[model samples]
Target: MSKQFFVTFCLLFITFYGKCQVTCSLPNKKAFETKIDSLNKIDLDSLNPSQKITSIAETFLGEPYMEKTLDIDIKKETVVINFTGFDCTTFVENMIALTKLYTGDQNEKYRTLEHYASILEHIRYRNGKLKGYTSRLHYFTDWVRNNQAKGIVKDITVEIGGQTYDKNIDFMSTHITAYDQLVKNDSAISAIRLIEDDLNQTPLSQIYIKDISKVESKIQSGDIIALVCNVKGLDVAHVGLALRKEDGRIYLLHASQSKGKVVITDKPLAEWLKNSKLNTGITVARLN
Candidate 1:
């Protein structure tokens, strides 16, 4: 089917189901369908959630890194499915969404592109509803916290030797010009400020950089690894899935800004964190 027709179908589906009105963007529709088809053929029954995450994540190994793909529409938000390129957050979110498609009900009705978009919306938006630009889970900690409440994932940072991550999260509101939506939109800025305020009081925890090595053995493959930032007013600087290589050390499988593509870190995650001044620690979560 043509991309236009597919998008129209998605719109009709969403409207018929009383879902939030949103545009769907699938730049590579054939590629997406092929991916879903291939994944559907896999025996996911044998694999655990972590294995399923890594199995799906490896498919985007060399995809180009593209920042701000979600900012396609200034006046409205789009359910964007871009297989061609990804930022760190999109890569991790899509990985979980795809895994959900397979692990969810086996009925054919649950495997359509619209269904995939629903899964993505659930993972990306707060409380699984798309009200506006501010509704997106811009903060990684908030994303984990909300998803954990829905039984999608569990924050395991504290269990693996994490300490309180006490930093005021007002980055987006403070740096308004950096975001186009927040620049001229007073309501968007106000919504973000409120979100930051709530997050600051949410009581977050992270594994400090100095202690990452001590708990490296406990972090499993396919665990979500959020690079906790030392920068002012920010909660997370980067995000990726953990991959325990044959060398028995966990490496970051992420969309690398430096490489301009998706890649596994050349060194172990602990050593990788040492190279960055902005990154102070990590917050780990597991798919439930």
Candidate 2:
């Protein structure tokens, strides 16, 4: 992708209050089409559909987080759609919004760029208390747990290649897109390390999978998983997505905010649970 495209993506989320008018009904499947319709109702008709997808993604970057609504779409599971600055709730919202593209479809499994508009819903909150609003964003874990509870989610697990290990060891109780399992583990970690940890170099992507089996075993076929790690006991860490795998090696893709969107990489089936936790002694959790 071009830097301009990436730049626009970042800005879209940043300029949420700048002049965008959301005019669609909330929570309704029709909201997807109408949300995109409002955008198309704009003067940017010259842009193609892909460009439009990027534009839509960028437009709702930080529209706050609504606990009951999923109104923003995170890029195809490959991208974290996260910057350290982008709080946890927004991640959940993005996931919902992006899914609008694939909602009501049976064959769709991964995030596709084709359904960009269906992902956005026109709505907002009058206050945190939640009253009459078009959107309802769920708390990250609550959202996932609820989805899992409601059957919208199949299960959560760690995966690489064609193999998946779903078991709850230590990290199964929380929700977060692990930096390692996130977009491109090495890339997300490297970029985050540069921006946050101030580290100079990172490992090539080696890991241990003791407890990972517990987590992967439960992950439903279409669910997204996060990977994380740090030193043995310290707290600093990296995160990412374990979208899926090919053959036997788990292939991953993520948006290392610092590195930009959806880049591909690979790792062992359980690259994060080296010593039963994220290899670096980090923590792992599911994303809402």
Candidate 3:
């Protein structure tokens, strides 16, 4: 879509769903717009969707890894989009939202921070509607599933020989106190329990760490990579974009909590997988 059409979509979306929206407050909102405007000035019309996403993600390489970038006041559950900082998941989330704005149907444009907010609401919520805390796509697997269902991405794990494993999700509700929003909201807690129950009824899959090396060449840049964990209740512990360097090696471009900033992994994909004992494997989703 073009810039004019994107602005139209944002206006229409807000007008249609204003009641369910949360107040978006960003201190550097204008600066972000300037940044995006500058990015738009680049000759990216010839690039594919994945290339656009990769280029966008690379721009934030040195951004600090601020934990809880999404957590706002407990009473307001807005779709938070912060360029000032990012966690691993938000890093992928923003890149995907920006990619959609750049390449979505040729007529789309994000003219303001609210436009980005609308894009994020669609990307981060169930059925693209921000109803409440429960509507947030908290789990990476659920995020993949919802976005894929909306035709935003496609799960390519099975095509790459991923094997099905028992699903064991429930971390959010079980550890309710850890989340500020979920602690006082009983309704939110109940909704999460339902989501967890549904997740438990299904089988999930991933490409085992042992097998990532075998298909490393098939991995492409801008592909969303979820680092699966061996933890009892979680499907993924971290996420990032697959960045293929000129040396023909695929490294992870992610927000490193350890380093307190975003950085591309020094080790290659397989070697990096070996570095984390908690990393059981990986699940990949390609943006459409």
Which model is ahead, 1 or 2, in terms of lDDT? 1
- How far off is residue 266 in model 3, in Å? 0.6
Residues 1-288, model 3: lDDT tens digits: 999987665433122234345443334364467668777777667788778888888888898898886676567677666777789988888888878777645443545566777888888899999887788899888889889999999989988778888967988988989898888888889999898888778788899988988888888899999999988788899999999999898899999999899999998888888767898899989989
After superposition, candidate 3 runs with Cα above 4 Å error: 1-26, 104-110
Give a tens-digit lDDT track for model 1, residues 1-288: 999988776544122233645444444555678777777677775788999999989988998999997887778775666666799999999899988887855555577777777888889999998888999999898999999988899999999899885678888999999988888899999999899888888787999888998999999999999999888888899999999999999999999999999999999999988877898899999999
RMSD, one per candidate, in order = 3.7, 15.2, 6.8
- Pairwise TM-score winner, candidates 1 and 2: 1
Best by lDDT: 1
Model 3 deviation from native, Cα RMSD in Å: 6.8
lDDT comparing candidate 2 with the true structure: 0.33
**Local error of candidate 3 at residue 229 (angstroms):** 0.7
Each prediction's TM-score versus the true structure:
0.91, 0.35, 0.89
Models sorted by TM-score, best on top: 1, 3, 2
Candidate 2 Cα outliers beyond 4 Å, as residue runs: 1-96, 105-139, 149-151, 154-209, 213-221, 228-241, 272-288
lDDT of 2 by residue, 242-264 (tens): 44444434333333343333333
lDDT rank order: 1, 3, 2
- The residue-level lDDT of candidate 3 at 16 comes to 23
Q: What lDDT score is found at residue 278 in candidate 3?
A: 92
lDDT of each: 0.85, 0.33, 0.81
